[model samples]
Target: MTLFKVLSYGKGFKGQAIWASVCSIVNKLFDIAPEILIGIAIDVVINQEDSFVANLGVVDPKEQLYLLGFLTFLIWAGESIFQYLYMKNWRELAQKIQHRFRVDCYGHIQQMDMRFFEDQSTGRLTSILNDDVNQLERFLNIGANDILQVVTSVVAVGAVFFLISTKLALLAFSPIPVIILGAFYFQRKAEPRYAEVREKAGQIASAINTNIAGVATIKSFTKERHEKKRISAISDEYVMANESAIKISSAFTPVIRMAILTGFLATFIVGGLDTLNGDLAVGAYGVLVFLTQRLLWPFRDLANTMDLYERGMASARRILGLLDEPIHIKDHAQAENIDLSGNIEMEDVTFKYESQTSAALKQINLTIKAGETHAFVGQTGSGKSTVIKLLMRYYHAQQGQVKMDGVLIENINIVSLRSQIGLVSQATFLFNASIFDNIQYGNEQATEAEVLKAAKLAEAHEFIVKLDQGYQTTVGESGVKLSGGQIQRIALARALLKNPPILILDEATSAVDNETEAAIQRSLKKIADGRTIILIAHRLSTVVHADQIHVLENGEFIESGSHETLLKNQGRYHQLWSIQTGGV
Candidate 1:
């Protein structure tokens, strides 16, 4: 996105922006008059009734004094009101920008393809979305407004100074060049240092996330000391990066202070001499002295303002980089909704993992007629799971197509296409939520009755009913609270609840014992009727009754036949069956 688009986050708040800006300008205007007021008060005591305001109109000295007091009250009061208004606007603008950027970042991330996530670290994304965005918000909330207000102060004060005494104004502004040059020098040096800090921070966050996620592995290998050392290294790198920026930024205030002192002394000496020689009035001299400090002291804060600006710009670059990641895979403009009816086919297809050097499936073709049970039998890495992945459209095929209902899968809306299929994998994953929630996760709007029915069909109802809280029991992270068999059955129940037209069981019973596997097979037999079902399991006995079976070896289908035919031929399927059943 362009800078204008990003800044447009403040569009709807034009009233707030204008009111706040007006308040800030007015506050500074009043603030500059106080020195003039000091000079005026001195003039009143010296000139008596002939004071400036009195000489202009009123002859009463008392009323003139009252008028001075009223002006003082208005100046102080205007300053206070504007202070409140600007603070409110800056804070509200910060909140709106923070809310907007975070939502847009998340929305963009959601639109990215699965491959993008696979190649990026979760901790890196988390840092960008949370910490990086927060840094940008902090700068906008205070820094941007401060810069604006400071510029206004310089301009307002400069015009007044030049109007009263051009020579004194020139003297007062002598240190400006020095201050600007110092700020520029430091800004150039601080940019890379701050960028390094952000990078190191991301590294530290990534290390912490990895260690926490793999805590079990660390304990299993007795590598606690090793992990601690690794974390310490990352933390130290971040600290060093911050220290580098701090070293440079810390010198900013002192240098500007020296330059400011020079300007203040010049204004006091030259303007004071002019007044003594009667070349300038005492009131004018007083205004010059007070205004000089007012104009120059704020420059001392340039170090802080520039610090915030540099940090904000660094963070903005990182955020924009993430948002700029090119999307390779997206929904085609002409893609239509999938009219799914469970009929599936693989036509002369060749597929490969994005990270792999060779294809996993080459020119393989197959068909599953509507509402039929088909089985894929393969050794490890023999392309059984690849076939399932192609059918699910997790990775696109390099050549040919996988189709659903006679339409190319690429032409189908991903949401509609996936909605028609349900899968239960070997290592079942469950969220740390209630059992009912886990089951209902397959179809979030599923009713309690539907969930129970699905659980009963998967033979999970017996154990679920035996639990302390029944379906309400918290499953713990990844179902660590349940046994292996219980998790598999719960996963099966989840898939059953979806009631999709096509079902895939990828070693769904491989993790279970004989009794549980048999129970699952019984449920599968019942549910497999009038639906396209694909079973992938090591236990060949499960697919003995399947309508068709394909045995794979080395990414090629070696045999495909019924149980009787395969047994008669005594091919790979027969050998797998004999090995699984112990040659019974």
Candidate 2:
């Protein structure tokens, strides 16, 4: 059933699958011909001028032997040719399917909502994409062909046995039902075990990924040995899971072999007795003995084939299940691109995280006009960053409307809407690439001159040029090579390069020193001519010159005014400002 599901999912490759299967069956047909040829050669030697070959008009014994040798050459050559064809077709098909599945799965993951990622681990997803997808590819490349050939061998050889003698044919196939029942039993027992093995594999992958990502923390805490033991514990669990599956699968082969041995011995002893009594031809008995091994030997490989099938199907289920995860945040059906002027409004908006009991933002109403500078100053968990997330449409508000320029945010094409806003968050992420590439990532089509200009505006150019490689320098993963201040400045420059109508600095200057922060503030002033700027910061000094500041406490604005007006009111904003300025 899982095989059929996988095949249905990849129906575009049906032609290649059929071609590979045909080649496998044909090669198997040629593979069995040698035994029949050996039987014919024995007949020729035993019957001489009255041989089956002579009956075909050869008459001479030597010429009959020569004809048989020629047929042997052709059969071997045909077998080799079809073997190559099937291998090439099957392997190539495997590569194509693997490539398509990985690409499509990754693309689907990119489109998933933020909540989906909250529930899944990066390591588990990576295992599905890399290990699980490759598992299926392995089955397609080898196991599929093996299955086809085994069936072909049984059907072709069985037909020959029945044509020669019914009673012996019946006896030869008697153990077949037993083998079938054993295979079914093993498959049923192994399915869940292999599924658990795959799950354990994912868990170990997650553990390793987590440890590697947090190696710095572990080292700082002097817990290297502890982490190692933790990972070893996970690995041991994985081994145990695999051992459980292996025990079930391993028992299959011996059971099948015993059944096959019964069938082989029955044909050998009975057919030999029949030949001696003159009831069966000596040549026919020889064919039956040789063909019985050919018919039954492949069943021994059934255990290994089923092992691959169960593992592959388990991985297939995980991969397909990930692909089926719903995309909760989707653009409206009739959504169209719009040229926004950055007029944002959240009218009585309420939002709660799926895992949380309390609302993050509660019936909040706010508005920011085009080309205006506004700042949200709040304590931790006061929903400053939540506002930015809603504005970017990363998460939809559970109630009320978020609109941009009078149009509901969901009604606008998501990509077009996000493209018009440049965001530099507190936690900056940079790829492991040259500094110039990281800055240019904001707008891929940005010119080198434009990137340099944005870097200058963010006050990162002076420090960057002082470095050994300057803009060409490689920043390690997540900009680990740079200091926090430097990384934050580069993130700002990247956003500046986008030159969007709205620029959001969500605690963007939190990592910089006072001097660097002052320089960035001056740069922001110069660039604040025709763009909307939303600043979320704890540093009251940085937002002193903003056109307006809203003080939020527990997801509601308790005070809203210009810096001087809020200070004059002597409310929560005045208390925060006084504490920071040491005037409390």
Q: How accurate is candidate 2 locally (lDDT)?
A: 0.91
User: What TM-score does prediction 2 earn?
Assistant: 0.97
User: Which portions of model 2 miss their true places by more than 4 Å?
Assistant: none
* Candidate 2 lDDT tens digits, 215-281: 8899999999999999899899999999999999999988998999999999999999999999999
Worst 10 residues of 2 by lDDT: 1-10
TM-scores, one per candidate: 0.91, 0.97
What is the lDDT for 71 in model 1? 90
The C-alpha stretches of model 1 lying farther than 4 A from their native spots are: 1-5, 9-23, 30-33, 55-62, 426-428, 510-516, 538-545, 562-569, 573-584
Worst 10 residues of 1 by lDDT: 1-10
Highest-scoring model, TM-score: 2
